[model samples]
Target chain A: MTVETLLLVAAALFGIGVYGALSQQSFVMIMMGLELMLSGAILATGTLWAMAAGGTPKGQLLAIVLVTVMAVEMAIGFALVVNVYRIRKADITEKLKTLRG
Target chain B: MTDVLFWIMSGISVLSAWRVFRTDSMVRAAYWLMVSFAAVAVILVLLSAEFLGLVLLLMLAGEMTIMAVFMVMFMMNPAGLNPMTMVHQHRAAIAAGVLSFLGLGAVGVFGRFPAGVSFATRDVTARLGMELLNDSMLIFQTAGVTLLATMIGALAIASRRGRYGLADEDSIEPAVENSQNAGEGPPSTEKGSA
Candidate 1:
């Protein structure tokens, strides 16, 4: 596929993810949406690495780092979620207004 | 032919990604996310980044499995048998989504990109490892430290222990001596509701 096609797909995915994150009240759902957005970004970067830069390992390294960080972020997010669920017995984001001043 | 395959994979990726949020079951959503990432991995492989593509597939599959387990353990409605909806401001969200997509699509299609040349090479994984250890060692070290801190911080925050090594007073699980009274050996491993 062309670079434009890749970017377009990434853009669409990220847009959908934004919608998901904004509309959903569940924390896990929000994280899933965020993950989808990041996947789109990773795909676009990989495409650029392959097409624009002649598929160099340097660009791929960035993709690797992004993927690794995403995994770690999700793990920590879920751990926090579980602890919250343990105490609150709820995962709805809107109901979590305790921090609201 | 390869172009056709790319289109198909892209379709799968985008559609499955949207399905991730549209689905009822969180487990199903996580699996859909995995499928979407797998399609992207195939696209990367098609683009000649084979090692990165494979790593993406392997890491995402394992991560999604853990996510599925956590979804069931923590979510209130794991089976999704009950009708549930937790959405808000969906109309506004849809409008924003459409606007953002159009803006990005316009930029991608009409923007002037840098005129760059392509290089001819293979065996990129070995070159990547060499460069990472030699030239990019700092980035690698930072990533290592970040991962280590994440592990430690997550465990410390989630643990039921306090700063003074005392167990949490609110913990529901029985003490070691009283564990026999709690009984029943931690239930079945069979998937889905009891």
Candidate 2:
């Protein structure tokens, strides 16, 4: 398949991820949505890399870095979630109504 | 052959992503997300990005496992046992998502891209590393430092016991022992009583 087709798929995945992040109440599900968005970004970068002049490796490298960043992001984010659960005893984002102001 | 593989991987990735958000339990959702990432990794491999595909698999698998463990340890709900409803404020989100997808797809399909180029060499991984290191080794080092900071920060935040505190001081064992001792009559009080 062409790079354009891959870009289209990535765009679709990104859109779905954004929808999940905005609509889902569960914190873990929201994180899952964010992961989907990152996955789309990785695909788009890889496709661009494959299409670049002189077959640029920069895009692939960037994708590698992004995968690492996503891992670290998930680690820290879940750590924070654990701390929040300890204090609040709830995992649902909607239940964080204490900050509704 | 390549086209068929691409279609299959794409379908698997998208379906698993949908499953991630649709599942009621957080642990199940995390596992579904892992499956989605694995499918995407396969797609990356098909694109000849072998290094990136393997890295994606390793990173996402580790992440999903950690998330599942955190859910069991900290979330108020029982570990994968409690039933939940996965409801959402979905109308606006659905509209926005659909519109964005249509807009992007239209752009991708209609936009003019550079002329097609044939692959001259097969060592894509080596080419990728050379190009990456040549252009911006500084940025690569910076990313490494950022990851280090994340690791340290996560440990700082998640570690329950400080240097001075006892681990499990408030655990169930002490409470259960106290209750059992109370039931068995206060440790033979008649030894000192007249």
Candidate 3:
């Protein structure tokens, strides 16, 4: 109903996303977390556009850019995951220690 | 009426996002994420961003399906037949999540944002189109190029064969002196001496 309410909801989504990203071992699950975080960002941006930005097209454009970023991130992330899985029979974060060096 | 719908969609998005990490099955997690996205799209529409909301739905449908397929392909327990806790540092993560939420929520509540309401009758989609083709044209073209590059890069990374050899195999360029041999065939498949 109000901008604050929408923003609070956005914050909640972002928080849950943080938990998911940090706690999950699976790469896909971690990505899901990032996606959730971006979802929050989109919602917040839309709320601001509707309530505070006087319906400016730039706010919506920003949201669209965020969406595009999400797509690029997902594409590259899955590609890396597939590659890693192919090279080593593992997908969890713990097993990616070889990447540290 | 709109207030009720807003609250409902907000609840749906948050709950489904929470469910994404809680579910054991990878497919369930991915689809749960999809549900969360769908609910957020509804909220966007309620906020009068009809075009953006619809586009979100369209983009996510394909993306989430791919995610589900990838989960099934790579996860050890795709169906979560065996209960497993594949997490570490759970307490710290929870603390961080809560703290970040509190901080952000406080900002949202306390921050003095400008007060302006969008007119419901305005054709936002047309305005957005004009913006894209006018002042924002460069940014729009840049995004298109970026997406094209991402597609090519993803393909190159995921493909089995690369410029030199099989991606899984140790790939090394053939020695320059061996040009005669290299010229006779497809990029040498021989695993180069490391």
Error of 1 at B132 (Å): 1.4
Colliding pairs, model 1: none
Write one digit per residue (lDDT tens) for candidate 1, span A59-87: 88798888877878887998787666665
- Lowest lDDT sum, 10 consecutive residues, model 3 chain A, at A92-101
Scored by CA lDDT, what does every candidate get?
0.79, 0.74, 0.88
Q: Which stretches of candidate 1 lie over 4 Å from their true place?
A: B165-194
A41-95, model 2: which lDDT tens digit per residue? 8887777666644456766767878887787878788877765565455577765
Model 2 reproduced share of reference interface contacts? 0.52
Best by DockQ: 3
Query: Roughly what TM-score does model 3 have, to 2 decimal places?
Result: 0.90
Where is the poorest 10-residue window by lDDT in model 2 chain A? A92-101
Please report the TM-score between candidate 1 and the true structure. 0.85
The digit string of per-residue lDDT tens for model 2 on B2-28 reads: 889998888888887888766656677
Better of 2 and 3 by lDDT: 3
Regions of model 3 farther than 4 Å from truth: B171-194
Please say which candidate is ahead in TM-score: 1 or 3: 3
lDDT of 1 by residue, B1-194 (tens): 88999999999988998888777788898999999999999988888778888989988888899888888876788777886777989899888777877887787788766535453257777887787898888887888888889899888767767687643455543233235544855445642455
Compose the digit string of candidate 3's lDDT tens values, residues B117-170.
654446989999999999999999999999999999999989998877888785
Better of 1 and 3 by DockQ: 3
Q: Candidate 2 versus the native: TM-score? A: 0.81
lDDT (C-alpha) at residue B170 in model 1: 59
